[model samples]
Target chain A: LAKTTQPISMDSYEGQEVNITCSHNNIATNDYITWYQQFPSQGPRFIIQGYKTKVTNEVASLFIPADRKSSTLSLPRVSLSDTAVYYCLVVPHSSASKIIFGSGTRLSIRP
Target chain B: GAGVSQSPRYKVAKRGQDVALRCDPISGHVSLFWYQQALGQGPEFLTYFQNEAQLDKSGLPSDRFFAERPEGSVSTLKIQRTQQEDSAVYLCASSLGAGQVNTEAFFGQGTRLTVV
Candidate 1:
């Protein structure tokens, strides 16, 4: 299992782009970077996932460096509703054993 | 249902009581997982099942916690002799399979368990 480290909390103004990075120094070769967002009283929703380079989706974008040791999740023009706890996970494609989550970054969007 | 569903969205149990949370996976999903989330912490993995077989359970905190997925669709997580530390949100998720593609897991709203 690859452990991820992210900021405990962040505050950003509305209409501003927010970028949160996650560090996985011991990431495995087969690991894929995945991000999820969780609102209060709800389960985590998938934001974006990527293996390397950049991957964009309707909600967020995931960027992974060539070394595969770090990844970033970017949300554009965020609104107050985007305020939630975001988690970054490194999952090995071939591993069926377990998937773990870090403390996660609590993003607060202020208007 | 259209997605994963968990029963008794909120449960309050007395200390030392036994509680059971149910999870109904999406139709035909092969991978089911359970996670426990504290107040301000990220979700911690509890157990996982591939079909009817429990492939991983090392994440279970103790023997008091047991999960079963009979028939490979619905799952139940039972915690006996619950303690105050067992208070948390129990989340259930299901995915198509553990393959590279479609590895994303669809999660249910989760069951909030409070032990008093």
Candidate 2:
């Protein structure tokens, strides 16, 4: 299992782009970086995932540098409804690998 | 057309009683997972099932927690002799299969368990 470290909280005004970085210094070769967003009373929703370089989706973009030890999740033009806890996970692809969730970054989008 | 669905969105159980939380994964999904999330904390993995076989349970806290997916479609997480410590939101998620590295998990509105 790979442990991830991220900021505890962040604040941004509406229309601002918020980027949360996660560090997984001991990431395994087979691990893939994934991010999820969780709103109150709801389960976490997948945002974006990347193996290396960059991956973009409708909701967010994931940027992974050459080293693969760190990744950033970018939320564009965030709105008040975008306020939620964001989790970064490093997961393997086989045998029902377990995902360990750290204390996620609490994102607050101001109006 | 359905995503994962958890039943009895809220469950209130007395201490020492047993409670069963159900999870219905998307039709034909081959992987199902159960997690426990406390208030103000991200979810912690509880168990994982591939098809009808439980492959990993290292994250389950204690012997009181058990989960089973009989036919590989619906899973049930049962907590025996529930304690106040067991009070937390129980979440279930399903994915295409355990083979793909980037398979996205679809999560259900978790079952909030309260032990009083």
Candidate 3:
């Protein structure tokens, strides 16, 4: 199992870019880094995922360095609606049985 | 439905009672997952099924918790002799493929369980 560590909370102004980083020191070779966003009373939504380097989607981008020990989720031009709990999950590609989540970073976008 | 659907969005059960939560995965989806999320906490893995076969259940906290996907599309999570600690939002997710790639997992609004 690969565990993730991230900031407890973050605050950013609207229209600004916000970045949340998660550390997974013991990630396995077959593991991949994925990020999810969750709003109040709703389930988590997939934001982005990457094995290494960068993965860009319509909503967010995921950057992974060569070490694969840490990954960053970048939200561009965030708005008040972007406020939510961001979860970083490191799951092994070999098995999807353990899609674990940490405390997650609570992102607050203000005006 | 468009995504994973959970029944009885809100459930209240007495202590020591038995309760069952239902999850209807997307049509043609091969993988289904169950998670438990506590207040102010992230979702925790509970169990996973790959086409009616329970491939992994290592995340289940106790023996009282049981889940089954009989027809490969509908899943039910049953909690026997529920406790206060069992109170949380149960989430269901479905993916188009197995756990071999970085595919997308669609989640539901989740079933909020309150054990009194």
Give stretches of model 3 more than 4 Å off: none
RMSD of each: 1.1, 1.0, 1.1
lDDT, model 1, position A46: 78
User: Each candidate: fraction of true contacts kept?
Assistant: 0.62, 0.80, 0.70
Rank by lDDT, highest first: 3, 2, 1
Best by DockQ: 2
DockQ of each: 0.65, 0.76, 0.72
Docking quality tier of model 3:
medium
Candidate 1, A1-111: lDDT as tens digits: 788999999999999999999999999887788898999999998777889999998898888889988998999999999999999998777736566888999999999
For model 2, residues B1-116, the per-residue Cα lDDT tens digits are: 58889988999999999999999999988988899999999899999999999998988999999999999889999999999999999999999877436788989999999999
- How far in Å is the alpha carbon of A53 misplaced in model 3? 0.8
Q: What is the lDDT of residue B46 in candidate 3?
A: 90
DockQ of 1: 0.65
By the lDDT metric, which is better: model 1 or model 3?
3
